[model samples]
Target: METNMTLYHGSNIDFEKISLDKAKDKRDFGRGFYTTTIREQAKEWAEILNYRSRRDGCFLYEFTFEKTDNLHIKSFNGITEEWLNFIVENRLKGGVQHSFDVVIGPVANDRTVNTIGLYLSGDYFLDEALRRLEYFKLNDQVSLHTEKALSYLKFIRKYTWTA
Candidate 1:
């Protein structure tokens, strides 16, 4: 990963600030500000959010992230046993599970979430969940879990995308 990277946050509403309080919990990385390195993925998120909110358009906010060694960072190159366990802990137990300021990893899709649910409900084993998750073509998500982490991301611009 580069020291400086471009990230995009997509939502149904335009915002000048990224608030962790406003973010939903039980996410893949717990409650945090999520951004993606892929623009198309961001766009898709915007569209999905817009539709869910019954909004006509969405906003794609761009940011420039300056990574520094001062803060703790956790990265997962792909879905693995460790990643799965970490995700399960965060999703099942709603709160910050780790001390990492930033976490870079694959976003759990709907199927993956369901698989996790099955695993939690005793319908699926750990190996089964991992096997199910393997089928997904995962997308990358960089989650800022702290205010200090948010400080590294500078808002660049915003684009309005219509349906």
Candidate 2:
């Protein structure tokens, strides 16, 4: 990993100056600075945020994280039983938190949400869920889970949302 890697976060709020103190609970990765390496995914997220939460245009904020040597990071290769279980635990716990500074993995976006529900709700087996989820190539999810992780971030720029 590079010492400085660019990460993009798309949101309805202005992150020019951010405060994670107000981050909501029960998030997919549990109230962290969620970002993606893929720009188009962020673009889609910006539109979604604009449509669902804000009247104003969605803002795309760029940040650089010193990923190589600065923090304790956990990387999940792809969607698997281990990844699914961890995500489910964090989401269901809602208030429960993790000690990891950062977590990098596939984002359980809208497409996977239903499938995740089925697996979690006992509607599908692990193999069955993996078979279904494999149809869609998952996008990356980068979660800055702790304040220490935030300290390593440098805000880059803000972009206007375009549908």
Candidate 3:
């Protein structure tokens, strides 16, 4: 189906209002994007609320959760810095598109008492493509296109954020 792809330049508040359930529904209809675990989904929602990127262009952030054993605040702080560095190095090689427009942090979260989070961001372009893909009538073609887009995004996120 033909689509008029529009850039998603809405406010973080608007993104925060995006229901996870609705996103899941879109995923279902689209049938390609993986559904993240509940914990990860919650954290994504949190990021949407707390997003603080400069308002100039489109960007994507990857949030990583790691379980830790130490409870010392100092140790956790140190780890957070290391994690940020790791994400930064990885993002550099991720081949993110210029259209991505922003590269933000991997806002950490405490998943459990011992767990920590590391979030990373860069550019993203597939969101608009996915939105357009939603109009395609052929389910198989839609699935293929969505999967390809997801794979490309994942590759960029993974390689860009890792050393």
lDDT tens per residue, model 2, 73-143: 87889888878888888888984367778888888878898998999899999999888887887899888
Better of 1 and 3 by lDDT: 1
Which scores higher on TM-score, 1 or 2?
1
* Worst ten in a row by lDDT for model 3: 154-163
lDDT of 2 at 118: 95
Choose the strongest candidate by TM-score: 1
| C-alpha lDDT values of all predictions | 0.89, 0.81, 0.26
lDDT (0-100) at residue 134 of candidate 3?
A: 35
Candidate 2: residue 4 lDDT (0-100)? 78
Q: How would you encode candidate 1's per-residue C-alpha lDDT over 70-96 as one tens digit per residue?
A: 779999989888898889889878878
Stretches > 4 Å off in candidate 1: none
